[model samples]
Target: MALMRMAVAAVVLLDLGIRSTDLEAHYTNLGVLPLHVLFERAWNPYEFSIHNMSGLWQVQALLFLAAAGFAVGLLLGWRTRLMTVLSWVMLVSLQNRNPMIAQGGDDLLRMLLFWGIFLPWGRVWSKDAEGQPAPASYTHFSAATVAYVVQIALVYVCTAFLKNAPEWTTEGTAIYYALSLDQVLMPGGRLLYPHFELMRWLTHLTYYTELLLPVLLFIPVGTAFFRTVFVVVLFSFHIGISLTLFVGLFFVINFASLMGLLPAPVLNWLERKLGPATQRCAGYLGGLRQRLPAWQLPLQVQATWRPRARKPGYALLPMLRETVLYVLVGYTIWWNLDGIIAPKYTMSEPLRWFGYQFRTDQHWGMFAPAVFKDDGWYIIEGNAANGRLYDLYRNGRPVSYEKPYSVMALHKNDRWRKYSENYLFVDNSWMRPYYCNYMLRLWHLNPRNPPLKRLDVVYMKEVSLPNYQVSEPKREVLCSCEY
Candidate 1:
């Protein structure tokens, strides 16, 4: 089973290599604009800014080479650990350099690489282990397996549970907006927009599948069936997003996750096909040991003769405990669904006062203009009547201030303005109005913002307000500027 999986992984790697040139072209082009921005900010570094790359293009090129090398190593199963590590590093660096360009697959790929590292992925099918005795059993349940399964489940569970929001369920319109969004991002977006109905159905299916996936995990027969279904659904999902959003990274990640669903027989077959060279390598190592000096020979023998620990019995008690724990954890996750799906919209009154709008405004002209300033430190000032300033920091250290302006005026800020000038400001007012309305129309979505209760306002005025009045102020005094 392990060998078959390795073979499958190799095949997948080959496919990726074949597509590398085209993918690299897209990656390189997407990164160029950010690289230029980073170069411009060569003096000061910002957390999502590219200010630190001394030789930005060179770094990107090196990363591409590293990714290619890792892929080759993966295919050959040579230095599998090192290769997996390098691949992860390359992919993560690329992602961190410009997260905006990354899609869902990029996130999944990075995680899957970590999972691959945890498994003895190279034990049976690797060139490095050629001719070594293959393990008697291949289906040992390790922490890596548990972690990988848990992580994958989390993605689906969270995504599904989160869709409980009015936007996803009520109108079922999330699909329409998502599909329509491509028209503005891609060159020929208009052509894709007409397929709104298809996109809508896709969206519905996605939400439904994600929501029910956790149940499928526990079902005996359903596990394999659901895994297959998920792969197909995710692949189609990635294809849709790629075509519409022009994001290919998500597609790769979804493809990689398919490894989890592979059968044991397939992996074993691969090992048999590739085990010869591995055996030869082991023989060579044995020969080298024989050539070792007398002084070191005893130590080597001692190292090889270390007593193996007895394996623990898989008793019913532990199984029951694990089952109970899994159920409890699942329930906990289900309870926290709101936080995962609509983090911005689901806050308490006090938190909402902090200008944490759950759903970010998508339309133009919703923002106010403001001049942001720092005195060897940071403070943001907003231009609109309801605007408020902010102090930004990370890890208790001050970084930069974030001045909240209407989405329309976000570009007016010198720092952000440049990003909008070249790249389409998909979040700006120009795009938001159509998207929000279109989504609302299709989904029959209701705003998540809670209505201001009369009693709640009275309490707020006394506790949180600057002054109180009988008739509540028509214009809201936006949140405070304190951290």
Candidate 2:
């Protein structure tokens, strides 16, 4: 127990130390005022605009300082409940203020911190009590521990299920898309663009591993070995993402979530360290009692010599109920295999066309009638004016041409325009704007011959475009142009 406590303490100390420098930088850059601007004015969930107190800098700063103080108090176990609430408020404010800079980690950390409030974490290893006997009931610790574990597992499982796409599995092109500028990888990621084959194999392996990780949790034969491997792979994956992607602080938050995996022994040791002072105080009270007269002893003390009643074991029904609950949970997971393994992919021919058109930004325009061959669709792009058109193959063949109105009508009926408009100015709007803007810019650059019209016919083929680049047009124009 003592060794476990020491290990836990060491881990906590190390985590705190590593985070300190980054935390200071985060505080300095964000501060209090900017956060207030976000919370008091920005729209809920979609912080698109600011509404009030646009320039009241001092007030914002004060609020920020108060929030920071509260967070520190919560972490140190001082007035923890109040501090926890304040910390959550402050954390949300900070995140909302600069949503662009926030990452997945901040969200995860805030959730974990919220759970911490319900635990008796402060009763031991805190300044309020240098030595104290920690609470024996496992109520708080057990619940929080379980919640953290479940949440972490869900995160991985959900992500794995979401990535079970044709591009991810069959073509292995998901990593290529992720590393592309269209995603959020580092600027120099193009250096690895040539190694698509390697990336494809790696992507498949990653997908398989993530999908199988949850099942590995319940297996006992080599559980520790599996856990170590899982941790190492996940940590390494996160490190790569942090170094090569612009996901902000998501990795940090995930690392913190792993703290729940620590053995229970560490917590017990911390309780012992907190007991010495409590024992001394108990001794002092005992001495005071010794000095009292014999008649002054409380009736409860005299009665203590009687045998105490023992609690009965749980009834058969209650035990059976718990067993049933465990079985149900396992069954629920197994029954949802469709949601877990086979996500909504293009199951039919018509659906495949809709899927391709839907995936591409052509929801409203005419789509060329193309057959879904073995290796995806075949498509083309053409330039009519100069009779200079490039053959665009998607997977490896030529694609049939569809009318512009057909594609446009589909997009309009499906409410794609609304979807695009919402994201261009709302949350989860990350890469959508860049893609839209690039297309619009391309059209504007060739204004007189608007590339869309000039491309009289496009033959769709699946061919990789190497060093493909699009330049911004000097003139700005509305994207909605009449054909």
Candidate 3:
């Protein structure tokens, strides 16, 4: 659990750093998603975002800073429970601010942090321990424990069941279609692209792995052996995915989620193999903890923030907490099951609102059902004041209809790529002009560059077809912003 906390916190800190790059563009009123438009179009009443309390980027920056601080606290296991809840809240709030930028990985990360709140993370390798010796054994079980393990299993099972499309089975070409997407192609994926036969076989392997491997987690005996096997297999599986796809942090987050379930055996082996080094590091960390007296004041200020273990007779808090957790777990299962069993089902208002309120609603759509066929790239066109047209994406160079050599690198990161994917839908047309104007404003920041008269957010669409057939690239102007 300590390892899981560190991994989740590291991912959160890294995510904040990457997102801060586009603070204004992605999260401010001055950029793409102004709060008024968001509340009007994409908002959910139950969805809460403290980041939206202010329109200025400065406020968002302050929030980002606070979130980073909490992630650091979680990483170091300082006030573990408090840090975990704060990290989860900050994560959900930031995600709610712009759901367009979110993906499966973001959901996984958020869910892990939410469950982390109930798990013990300050036991070892944590400042909260303050030189407390390691537990003689690393085995435990609780409501949170059961929920965490099953949560990981549900991710795979739900996704596998949702993939009812024939392409994943009879066609066995889901991987081919997925890699054919130039917009998200990775360097390693290019090498394997020619081996369609291998890709075909791998597709079936992936399906069964997701569908069956998670069952081992529930085996009644040899828990260590089965858990080890599951971790090694899926860990390698996602590693292969990372090398062959441009999924931003999805693979990494999966790796972290898997770490929490690693059986006692593997961890014990690691400790034995690195005993000397581990002891030295532990001593150093213990000394560091002793030196840090300042960390305790704020921790005391927020003393009421942490949950106290109830007295033997006090049943109300325990009962209420347990009831809510069980309801959340049951609701989560029902939500996923409804999708698989009744393909066209929506949760009734109360349940749906509950999901939104707690941010427990989730679906692991990692290319589920069918591979996306809209394989394309964006072309940001700028028309300058002196009858000059430039390709702003190429740094104000002459305009061209041709695609770049590396289309995958076009997006700043997976967030933008996911946002761009959302931008492709006609229902999201309202977002285009904001993006266009945002780009225009950015381009004019350089005084050497002439002001643009207008800007065009264009997408060159290419639809992927069966048997390696490719459609001609179509020039589609998604949004035209007049300056």
Residue ranges of candidate 1 with Cα displaced over 4 Å: 1-53, 164-167, 184-202, 220-245, 265-338, 341-483
Give lDDT tens digits, candidate 2, residues 85-116: 66655555544444434334544555555445
Q: Provide C-alpha RMSD values for all models, in order.
A: 18.2, 16.5, 4.8
Candidate 2, superposed: residue stretches over 4 Å from native = 1-55, 96-103, 120-125, 133-141, 187-191, 218-226, 264-483
Tell me the whole-model lDDT of each prediction, alpha carbons only. 0.42, 0.42, 0.85
What lDDT tens digits, residue by residue, belong to model 3 across residues 67-173?
Answer: 99999999998899999999999999999999889999888898898888888766666788663434544576767887798899999998888788898978899
lDDT of 1 by residue, 164-264 (tens): 54536655555545433211234333455556566557667767776676565556674556665665666676666555543333445555566665555
Provide the lDDT at 433 for model 2. Answer: 30
Indicate which candidate wins on TM-score: 3
Which candidate leads in lDDT?
Answer: 3
Report the backbone clash tally of model 2: 28
Model 2's TM-score against the true structure: 0.48
Write the number of the candidate with greater TM-score, choosing between 1 and 3. Answer: 3
lDDT of 2 at 288: 40
